[model samples]
Target chain A: MSRFPAARLAGVAALALLGFLLPRLLGGSAHVYDTLTTIAIFSAMSYGLDIILSDLGEISLAHTAFFATGAYAAAILVVNYGESAWVGLAGAVIAALALALVLGLITLRTREFAFSLVTYAAAVVCMNIAANWDFLGGSDGIVGIPPLALTLGRFSFVAGRPAQFWPVAYLLLLFVLYVVARFRRSRLGQAALMVHMNPRLAAMCGLDANQVRLHVFLVSAPISALAGWLYAFQRAYVGTDLFDTYFLVLMLTGVILAGRRLLLGPLFGTALLLGQKNFASLGAYGDALVLGTVLVGVLCLCPRGLASLWRRRAIPGPEAPSLPGGPVSG
Target chain B: MNVAQQFANGIIIGHAYALVAVGWTLLLGAARLVNFGHGQMYMMGAFVAWWLMSATGLPYAAAVPLAVLVGALLGALMQRLFLRLTLSQDLVNLMIATLGFGQILQGAAGLAFGAKPERLTSPLQAITLGGARVSCSAQDVLLVGATIVVFLGLHWVLRRSRFGAAVRMVAEDPPLAALYGLRVAPVYLAIFAFEGAAVAFAATLVAPRTPILTSIGFEQVVMTFVVVVLGGIGSVGGSYVAGLLLGLYTAFFSALVSPAYTTASVFALLIVVMVVRPGKLAASGGFAR
Candidate 1:
């Protein structure tokens, strides 16, 4: 265990390379490109929630709001201001961070149900505002967002089609994964884990629980928002529909189905979900049923998630502190 | 904008809110559990009553009790499914499970009832109170009267009954209650079942005021959150008073400002309350404390 295990790392890298090429290898159809691009985008969106649920040990129903904030920010900038993808991306990040700061502060002192409900309320309010406020395009939303334009000195790319959008989506997913991986190893990440696992210890170690929560939220929101930024370019339209509960349920299902804390769990989970929705074709209602069932089944039957099913001695003991309504006073 | 009219509107809306929120208040009071599927349950109740009235030629009043029965069954089923989590006191998972149930209910309702909204017509809606000065329908009057009855009944049951004592004991500490051999499981089940019945009753009364849609579940009960949270989590009487206050706030805010942004404004008010009274919120759920 102490050794570098270079061969294992190489094998994992090779597998990732094969995954990256598999879509291209299989006929490269338009449907495949669109489907895969969606998986990538949705998976990226889920990672923002992954950190909050897994590391911070908090459920944030407002990530949908952040996702919308990103999509709207990008669309408004690109469509109204005639800005490029870079500016849209920046605008998306800024919008998400601002919203997160406010939400995080509002919920800093809340726990469990209160925190979740507050976040849910915030998301609902965001939807209400986006739907009613004309400046944000009201219910019509910002439409006809231009194709993504990214220019790094001489290097340039314009992705107007789903096929052309694949690399961009793939790259965004990779960047988000990298960010998440780094986050798990960062000081804040460790602090968050401590705070979640043992608040007493976290306090004894001189960490402010609320501050850590706020910081993590600030970081997590942009990850989802960036996904929304790319999604706006792909769809060429951003509407209040971005605030739909479908995305919220999907994000939750993705994060939990494949297990929490695993770097590629959300990616795998999103791929599996989109694969079912795309290929299997359960009508809207059926798909919702499937998503809902998966969330409930996993949480009820295997709280550690499906990943635990593969391992021996995988059942998490009930001795672990329960977050919902356990003895934890606050 | 007659002041009396607005006040009348506030009372009607306030009663509706309190009735809708009462089940949740009881559930929270008994267990620290939350049903994200609550609004969907309300939707289900309305649809069931509407279906009964339409399909079986049942009167609106007769269909309400039947709808409440179905709501009670749903609550029992949810409690059964979530019994493990409830026993373990695993709130996070329980919350998510409730969310999943809500989604399933919403999706199923959409398929069963279709996408378009349907009005739950009541005979009482035809009976108007006044000419044009500050009129309200008989349905609105029934709603206010029903809310008062429900609240008074709940208060009596909770404060003056042995079952109420058992529930409060469990709410204070399930493990301790169980240790004292108070049958914790039954208490949890009863509270959940009550939540279902109470929300359904609220639906039959309040849903008549507007069109019922499958997707309105979460949004429908958003105000319930304000009522329950502001009224002090599990406080029965507090929920009623809070509902009235929220009703007044909504009535005045929409009448004076913009109706479109009333939800947003209510949520803003909720956030302000949380910010100012974080400790108070944290201290919620402790029955005697």
Candidate 2:
């Protein structure tokens, strides 16, 4: 009740600060670094999906197409043309963005069921092309992708193993988060909320509802593609399944369950989802079970997502939309 | 086989697609959302019938209907359990939830039934017709026959019965129907269960003809979905026609092209239809005028 209404948030932030520092202080060992790298990659990818889900209320189970496209683009550039990792990364984002634009323009003009059918089909087609095309290594994917190089950056991750991936992944995660945060606050972001709220009203206000959605979708796709690119690069190989259905499902669960009702929900969802890769017996299924449970639970219980927990505690500046006004299409 | 025989084989495949297509059309039209888990239900029905008649002492007639009932109950459970929580979310989420539900069912089947193909006994021997000699096994004939009967029955129900009126009323306008004393929720649940029964029935009919395996559900659902969309989303009759058309297309196409593109070709057809007239597939607002 005191004037400093949410002192608990400060404590939470302090704890986060300490936890993050502890990893660096402990000298980011290989095993620990791999886990951290996955967390960063997963979080960044989840945020990309939020453009469709939490921001626009659209569901994109096909985001993995973007990821796979980016990774392949990067690898193809490096292996075929001898480009650096940064060039590959930039190229991946551009490729993802272009595909997203075309996909978004066509699919978002329609309503619920149609939206799903088109997007899912698009992703499946992409996976098929990748799988069947011999140049992409058919089912084998691109192996032996050279380590992403750096010329001008102060923080360069000279990769010998996946553990070496953290520094580069961490930087990419930071850049993605920073850019997305800014994008969320701009007029374009507000236009997104407007279009989602009531397209008729948004149109009345002189906004092109469909165009705005297309823009957001295009943007989100590249982000996903960037994540895919990094994942493929980090792992040093891309396989057919990299852009296939299961990848899409995992990405959807993370982003949708994240509930961008607050900023932290997607991050939390990503951490929980990718973490299930640990248990030996559960294996591939463990992530799926957790996804099913969390999706059902969040849809039923905490529609706003875990991030709302942070948003609820007396923070007064931003007036984030309540979960009921969630951006998803009904 | 002669060239004519190959063409005849395509129609046989069309018959298979018809069963799934009709079910998908009716369900999506009435339910407002689709169940990706439906293929799983079809697989279950087949497996259940396979187990009952082929393994246990129960006869085929009893097993088929019995399997249908089980599928309906599971459908009701899906509605009562998952859809119950999801009505408030975006339809996109609902679709994904159903897909997740399908995955859960697939995994559960893998755990419970094992990932092997099983066969069921056909109740009736194949019947010959005209100059063409196609063996209509009891199960296949029964299934295709049941599909025809169900369509006629659905047509009658939609055009005639009070239950049909309630469904049309609600789908056309939910609140207005509620004002007219139609109970919307129960009718919706009934439709969900009804669709499940259809899928199960299709499975019971199909099990004798095709190899029953865990992977069969995905193909069945995709085929059904394609037919439903092609026929136009909410038109029950459109589904039947579309189903037959697709069945014929795949039947002939496979005879010409490889079997691999059969599914991909269906998807391509859907994309073409969608791009041409987006509203046709929407299935609401009464056939886009």
Query: Once superposed on the true structure, which residue ranges of model 1 sit more than 4 Å away at CA?
Result: A5-9, A313-330, B283-289
Query: What DockQ does each listed candidate score?
Result: 0.58, 0.36
Models 1 onward score TM values of 0.96, 0.85
Best by DockQ: 1
Q: What digit string (tens of lDDT, one per residue) describes model 2 on residues A54-100?
A: 67766675677787888889888888788887788789988888888
Give the DockQ-based CAPRI class for model 1.
medium
What TM-score, to 2 decimal places, does chain A of model 2 have? Answer: 0.84
**Residue-by-residue lDDT tens digits, candidate 2, B1-289:** 3567665565666666777656566667766676677777788888888878766779888998899898888778777765554344345556777777766666566565666787776746355444645443444556667778888888888878988878887677666777888777788788878877888888887777768886566546777777777777778777778777887787777778766556667777876777887768655754211
> Which 10 consecutive positions of candidate 1 chain B have the poorest summed lDDT?
B280-289
RMSD of 2: 4.7
lDDT per residue for candidate 1 within A1-330, as digits (tens), equals 227678767876898688678678877998899999999999999999999998988889999999999999998888888888899999999999999998888898898888998899888899999999888999999888888889999999989887899988988998999899999999999999999889999999999999999999999999999999999999999999898788998999899888889999999999998999998967888888888888888878887777767753576555655445332211
* Alpha carbon deviation, residue A230, candidate 2 (Å): 1.5
The lDDT for every candidate, in the order shown, is 0.88, 0.70
